[model samples]
Target: MVRLADVAFAVLFVGVVVRAAVTDLLVPASTLAGIALVVAVVGFSLFDPDGGDHAASLVVHVALVGATALALVLVLTDLTLVSRAVDLALFYLVVLALVGYRRAPLSSTISLFPYLGAFAVVVGLFLLHSLDVSPGSGLAAFPVFATLLLGVCLFVVPRYVEADFLLRFVGALSAVIVLVGLPSLFVGSYSLPFFSVSPWSNATLSPWFVGELPVLRSIFPNPNTLGLLVFPAVLGGVVDLHRTYGRSGSVSLFMVVPGVFLAINAVGLYLTNSRASYLAAAVGLALYAAVVVIDRRAVPVLFAGLAVAAPLVGFGVFRGVVPIDPSNRFALWGASVEALLAGPTLLGAGVVNTSELIAPFLSEGLSGQSSHSSYLSIALRIGLVGGVAYCLLVIGPLIHGAWRFKRVDVGMFALAAGFAVHQLFEGYTLFQYGPGSILAALVVGYVIASVVPEAT
Candidate 1:
């Protein structure tokens, strides 16, 4: 029994897709694949979460996760229209899905203060001149706000999808991505025609190198981004493998396959040589182990330990013991901070303004100086208040969910925690709706949704 909302969503989705196709007749095959995926995922969003145990719901579950995974992978490409379409469709779905749903109790609704407050503050700042918005920054503004909207959508859509299914799909797809890209180590580069590997068509040695070795970005825009995308697979695969081991008490195909994929993800992460991702992997796995091996009580201890160690770790980075070259990151961060303070209000500089302000700080001949840290990026864009709200949006639910410690909850919490940690080093977490941001939003949304009480 389909609801009226289903017909409405389908009609609207088709209209949007057809208009997009008309606007860009020369769209690549991968773009089409991405559009199809967005449709499947969004279309399946209409299903009630209670139906998740049924066979039809099971198929829809796989389709939604599979479509989301593939579409996100395609997001790394240069397809503008598909990216826009995905953002719009996601926002619409999130808004429409809220209709007819039971409201959470006041306590649960109040838990949303961080998210709502942050959004309101940012928009208020934008509407007023509290934060400066640069001319021709619509490109930056559109995606940032769109990403914020889709991030909320991820939270809503999970009310209708199985978080467990998402983990399994992530694990399976991570293995596939790793396996497909592994050959690049020997072959120098790997890309198919349909992939439309940006800047050049055929495979070529990546201009970027990690300590003399050509980094393996594979299908992603950079090695760090690839590592960002693959680390979740490690967590997802672990969950699947753990379940298989617990159920059978012996090796089985389910165990063997995920095990192999887990290894592949490890190798993939290694190939990227991303220290940030490596740290993220370690942090995520440690959290998972703390919960499973020790107790949920250990989760807070681990976080406390990490917090204490962060400053000491900075000392190592400065001393060169960490093997990380600051790569002028400190300079960029400092410049961003200075500009943020120079603003008229603590609401901070808007997106384009922040980026443009930091440009001159780059060393001569260097350009594109984005705040490499997501935390810093948010601070620069929306100031300390908004940054705190974003942090709460990411971490507050993890703390609440930590109490439950169910399988899906634990796996997603670990995944979301790791992604959050990754943001300390990488800038692609919140404001960017690209592959890494999309994956993070989905995982974090699931974690938050799993812990939140649902309407009947």
Candidate 2:
């Protein structure tokens, strides 16, 4: 019955992808796919005796459904796009949590160190800041806060699910992402024409845009959001590579796939030209290399060395590297710090609209305001205490996960470490409107679950 439901879901998903490819209905198609997935999940849950145990794995599932229902109510009543998107994202997270729960073991459930700590801090800080802020601002901040909170919950819940099932599910999902999800991004109305330069078009275009391929922006509203999703998969591939090679024999095959994935992602990141993402990817790779060094793994060291070298080669090829533009980042950071130091009031400037908060301070030449830095953005809206607490909340899980990895599971350790590095530069997980934060939460939950022993 579960297999039948999976098949049905797959068929529906394929239909949505085909429609998205041929029409301008990408958003609607994605929405339909999401809805279909929800129905499939419900059907499967209702029919399967194991569903109860699976449901118990993901506590956040209820919260996600409630959030989605609320968002739907607001949307039917004509709520803002941001509101709708937040709710939709919540729904997606819930679905993912359910999937995780269904596949994982109950004994594996237990809150790991850093993530739990991080959640506590974020909640405490946000509440304190809420006291000082306007009701609207507080409300706006709620989605972002909820995303983080739910994510933390998802990250830990996998521990309760079966490990073998959890790993198989992740592996299969990764395959689908590469095969279907990625291909879908490059074809149809959802297709990024920027990537496909036909001979005729190429001949006519200026050299600047000529060689560049459109990176995978997915269904994300922007490239930055796309980067957030892709980054983790890239790291996961690297982790897989490390594990595969450790098994002995078939070393060449183990080395090849990960190397190719790394190269593809690096090129993708460059094409997106997201400075933050570039920084995050670089940091993530560096951390991975550090782990390799600690593990004394020769192949990884060689890979890391090559990774370090690729940028130099690219710099030479591109010539004239983009100038460092830290001025705006610095200014924003300064303002955020100043705001925090000014007072200890809770309930920050009430869910401050990102744009409104930064409009006054931005230079005329600055293309857009709104704190580009997630940490600063949260701090400005929630206050210093909340901001710091939020940071702690995120960092705590990774730290604990990493420690556990050192003792028990290496693959999960790598994942947590890689994500921790990725978050430093990008703000996707901190945002209110996409899969970035939720995915991060899910990955963290998986890591914690994988590493910790089942509770007695």
TM-score of 2: 0.58
Model 2 error, position 447 (Å): 3.8
Worst 10 residues of 2 by lDDT: 197-206
Candidate number with greatest lDDT: 1
Q: Which portions of model 2 show Cα errors greater than 4 Å?
A: 1-149, 160-221, 252-263, 296-323, 340-345, 408-415, 431-433, 450-452
lDDT of 2 at 375: 67
**Could you estimate the TM-score for every candidate?**
0.71, 0.58
lDDT of 2 by residue, 1-456 (tens): 234444443344334333333343433423443444354344444343333454553334555555545543443344655654554454444434433333325544434444444554554444444334443443534543354335433542343333323333334443433343344333433333422211111112122644434444444335565456455556656666665676764577646755665556544445444555565555555656676667624324433454466457435534536565543555555555555555434545645565566555556675355565666666766666666666664555555544454443444444544555555444444434234554455555665555555433
lDDT of 1: 0.58
Return the top candidate by TM-score.
1
| Alpha-carbon RMSD, candidate 2 | 9.1
lDDT per residue for candidate 1 within 1-456, as digits (tens), equals 444333332332233223232333344323433443344345454554443334565464445456444333333334434444463344333332332122335654455455545544543443333223442244424443344334434544455445555566566665665666656655555457534222222223443453334556665556676676678877777876876787999887767767887888877777777778888888888888877798666765666676678778877987778877877667778777776677633666655545676776666654676778887777777677767767876776666665544523677778888888788877764544455766676677777667665434
- Error (Å) of candidate 2 at residue 71 is 12
